[model samples]
Target: MSNDFFSTSNRIKSTPFTSRNNMAGVKKYSVYNNTLIPTVFRSLKSDYFHLIKHVQIWDVCCQKVIEVRGNNALSLMKYLFCRDFSKIVSGKSYYAPIVNFEGGLLNDPVVFCVEKDHFLISLSDSDLFNWVSAINHTKEFYADVNETDILTIAIQGPKSEKLISKIFGEEIKFLKYFNFKKFFFNKESLIISKTGFSKQSGYEILLTNPNNGILLWDLIMEKGKEFNIKVGCPNMIERVENNLLSYGNEMTNKDTPYDCGLGKFCNLETEYEYIGKSSLLKQKQVGFEKDIFKIHFNYEFDDQPIFFNNLPVFKKGIEIGKATSIVWSPKYSKYIGFLIASKKIMNNLNDYYILDKGKFEVSEIL
Candidate 1:
């Protein structure tokens, strides 16, 4: 492993569970949303297998919540993303891409409808608060936009439901996917939702008090002892295989929602108007010229692949696209990742070369 300099300061915040992570011997961290996110604890392959077979408690406080409350909260939401809010009933969450006026992706957040008028935008790694605040300031909307102190913790894996049920009761295990319910822990009410970034069966606890962070972590760890719970963050290999897209990793402000394969989430012809609706409609008419793909290598890689940015992909010695995310999957025994390619190459999911050497095959997100 190579040592990279990462400084700590007021700007880079640590979650309340940082100490616990330290105790767990967290090996590495990556910054997300100006917060320290644990990238590894044990070895990568070990952590990946643990996450697949057992349970993991992840300090996902970096998944910040931008709360929108008041009469015009729905109006602000309507103007922010392209999702049809009418379909998002209370106690449910909807994944939507927040775009700017030019149809460029600002952030892809999971909007949670907490109540009739109150909603929480659980954002990815982006400054969504500023955008919402600016919108509220310019318009005479009755919505209040502010970042909440609520820290998010995720319990994920095959055994997550059993472990959560041991503490929160069996009723919580029955909570439908994408639904949330308020539960009390030590007499403090906190929200737990059946939503997570991982494809594994899991729940994200939206903790209200930062003080309860370690307390909750301890309780879960204690109860989850039987299930062999591990302290792990999001696994790159698993996410790539599942085709989960990261915000800054897969798509950014430079790309539109259509470019990131988010067109299905957009309803351009809806009666409701949102920010970038016009741009999205125009882009829809023009159609997407570039998009993301999930690719698999023909041969195994001796070393795990980590891509911070795009890696040039070539076809017949000519650069055609760039890969955003890469990982060597132990489950599939293959190198798998996501890449952006032109419509011509993207339409034909076939053999290609990366780094002008390796043979690979690409496919749409399955």
Candidate 2:
């Protein structure tokens, strides 16, 4: 709610999404670069959910961009990923999931193919930077990797295309999904990619110069006057319907890429040596467990209590699993959520009862 939160600079603030340690009350995860606004779950769910359905500008600089540049950039990346980046041409962006040695999902970051030798990895959280740095320490690859807290702004919603088209001209409309094009504003170079969190068309603009962050934001707001633009973040309800995976919610390093339904992004055919290629291949060949499912509530309850599944799900008094991301869809008027459980429980979806404030039978499958 504070405009000061959006001010350009590195300053971390604790919110509901962040947790504090008992003795010192220290926050577990600090929003890096400090300039980005930290919108909490409850605030986003109640106040801004409907507002974000319209167009809005968000200071996502905290999302951060890590630059991997040098002669050996591609070769270095090959050693870290299962995907083959050798054919990844310039001016393209790809949604690739970073996996560990056991093919577990580390982070799902967007890889921007800036040029044949230069690549930019846009991270959702700070973990990606540490992972990249850790890999570099082993001297397993030869590339210069530097982490930069570059400013990133997401202009999302239905009218986003119009607002952007006006600022950068009609040329932006030609840029396909996951494709980026360099443009100049006040002679300052910026990268605009046709990508965002909403199901509606939008763009994520990367400003190399932090000084231009406010300038770019102001210009967009001015031009967006007719579009009814309201500054907001990506809503969970919208993302859930689209089946978009939230970083910490859907899957984590504990879950393998195959378990999270991201196996397609793992390109095992690539000849390059990667971190956990052999382990991943072995898991795949031996047949790993799969628990991809959608859980629905049979009846509605109070908004607050029904928002999250606080009780443990059990079959015959045996704990199986718990719910992850839950959202009440305004569009569907149904409470839907994504849950991870054993393959046995997942296969018998009908028997599973999602206990909210009250018991709601599993209404549908994803």
Candidate 3:
């Protein structure tokens, strides 16, 4: 999460409603897209339980959106591999894995079809806007790419529906998962989507007017008082248990879509030409050696393994993989993590070790 003090700079930015986060007792912060995001409101352990039981408003403005306009917007989207965007219609959000020419992962973002020929690509941690802009630089596709001034706020948790209904009304029930609709609140239009990074069901509200951010946040907070709603951020423990992958933590530019276990979304065919079509096709035929898995570490309740960095995994002295994300799952009363391991090296019986540290139990992500 955060190291605390947030001083806005050119590179490290602050959102419009960042003051609200600080006022809400935000304890930690993480810089995403150059914006200071509240990673922890109270404490990870306490905030996590509250998030699952009640409701939380998250300042996710760091999750920026890249707007693409014109007739070739769909064509540009087609160039984004590991997903078929031809069938994607307006009002839907697709979890598309953006890949490069070498089939290496770029950014796994949700592409929102706002309207026909108008789309928004919500980014993760990376500066994918330049890459995307460069792709359409020649204007050959006739697609204009620009970063939107919009900011995002997420209402996540089990009680998220009830909290959102208090302001948005009961009609929100009709909004399906990965679906978004324009709603005007206090005369300000907001695109609300039934999607979030948490395992808990939630909605992400896209604020076009940055000035209206605090206004909207305050409105939700007031309505959320009944639901015991608290200001929150993405909990590492909850995400680890839920296997909700974070870009820089779970993956990087070196990893491919297949390595990330995103092959199911890769609809590779000769019909659609994308950046990584050839390499993905080759990997499809040759197969991937490394893949991601969920690991169950030593499960003693007192075994609070707090290694902040990744621990390498080995089988009989042969390096197999490493635990990319690790946490103590309070709900499970055990240590769990997402391991990026090689398939060939994973065939063993109780021989896995965290390098020279010690022996540990390994489990695959289901």
Candidate 4:
């Protein structure tokens, strides 16, 4: 990959771009912080409601996909995860946490079932390729794995059904969440899945060619004109309210899936053994000291300036917990944030006060 592949611009512009095939002109936007580009795109609204009511498209190339193929792929996956992939059917998806032996979450990636024998792992910010390599280092495993650079476009909103129907027809409407269907555009095969980060209904198109990315983007925007379509990224307010956790924000390497409130997804029912099963089983029996919880704060704070408590929130100067992501919900007309605190502290909810710039009592917990 070349550094010149990415360039900065003040406005969205159409330029000659190269994909797996050849040069195809596509429109690109130059964003400030590359990490925030996804959120920024979703913030732009064409309707009165914060929701992207009509339609919206995203060039989420930043989220890379790694494909694992060849014999023993399933076995390798079985060794790497606690999720029972054996039950996953082709064209479906499963969400699981890839953990180490000590039960630390390495990366929370979505495992997509492209075929009974092959799979694609979608990663957020972590380098999944390195993780895959580390798994392969155990010579006892027999599998061929390769990582591929892929680009994806997310088409979301209520009108998404109608717009996608025009291209793929009414069959697409039946595609269940976490399910995918394959279609051809310009004689090239593309996979579209009924999944996205937003709680709202949507579809994501995976394309190998970058040129096709621009064409699909333009086509959706053009066709979406009647639907009052807009271009944007995933809705932050909607995601948080729905309890959809992001990678680095809600969970990290230091946190186990159980601690992050994803313990239900951890499957201990399987006869086949996995890497972190022992630790997870032990944690389950012993119970966790802290658990992720949704907390509503009673305070007014600016959204831009990342707010942090001035004094360490404590029970008689003994720290109990700290706040994570916080946002003011215009719809709910209240302040909401996520917190990881001692189970003892949570038991006494009335005593817990969030020190958001100043001390404020916790209004409620969900």
Number of backbone collisions per candidate: 0, 3, 2, 3
Clashing pairs in 1: none
Model 1, position 46, has a per-residue lDDT of: 82
Error of 2 at 9 (Å): 12
What is the descending TM-score order? 3, 1, 2, 4
Model 2 is weakest, by summed lDDT over 10 consecutive residues, at: 19-28
Instruction: Give one digit per residue, the lDDT tens place, for model 2 in 1-366.
Output: 233334323355322212111111221122443433334433445434544546777556666678998887887777777667768889999888788877777778888989878889887653777788778767656577888756678888878888999999998889999999999987988899989877777899987765576677778878988987755666667777677877777777778777777777878778777877888888879776766666666564454543563345555556666666776666566777776666766666566564542366667767
Using TM-score as the measure, which candidate wins?
3
Query: Please, what are the lDDT tens digits per residue for candidate 4 over residues 1-366?
Result: 112445534333222222311122222233321321334432322221434466766556655688877677888888888788777798997787888888888888778889877888877656667777778766456566776656777887778889888877888989999999899987889999998877668888888887777777777767888877666666556666678887777677778888878888789778888888888888878887678878776665444432332223555456666666666555555656677766776787676564633456667777
lDDT of every model, 2 decimals: 0.82, 0.69, 0.82, 0.68
Model 3, 71-163: lDDT tens per residue? 888888887646987788999999889888898889999889988799998999999988898888753786989999889999999999988
Candidate 3: residue 55 Cα off by (Å): 0.5
Report the Cα RMSD per candidate.
2.6, 5.6, 2.2, 5.2
**TM-score for candidate 2:** 0.86
Candidate 1 lDDT tens digits, 170-275: 8996799999999999899999999897898899999887777788999999999999998899987678878889998888887888887887888887787789
- After superposition, the stretches of candidate 4 with alpha carbons farther than 4 Å from their true spots are 1-36, 41-52, 300-317, 357-359
User: Given candidate 1, what's the lDDT at residue 29?
Assistant: 89
Q: What TM-score would every model get versus the actual structure?
A: 0.93, 0.86, 0.94, 0.85
Clashing pairs in 2: 10-33, 11-34, 101-276
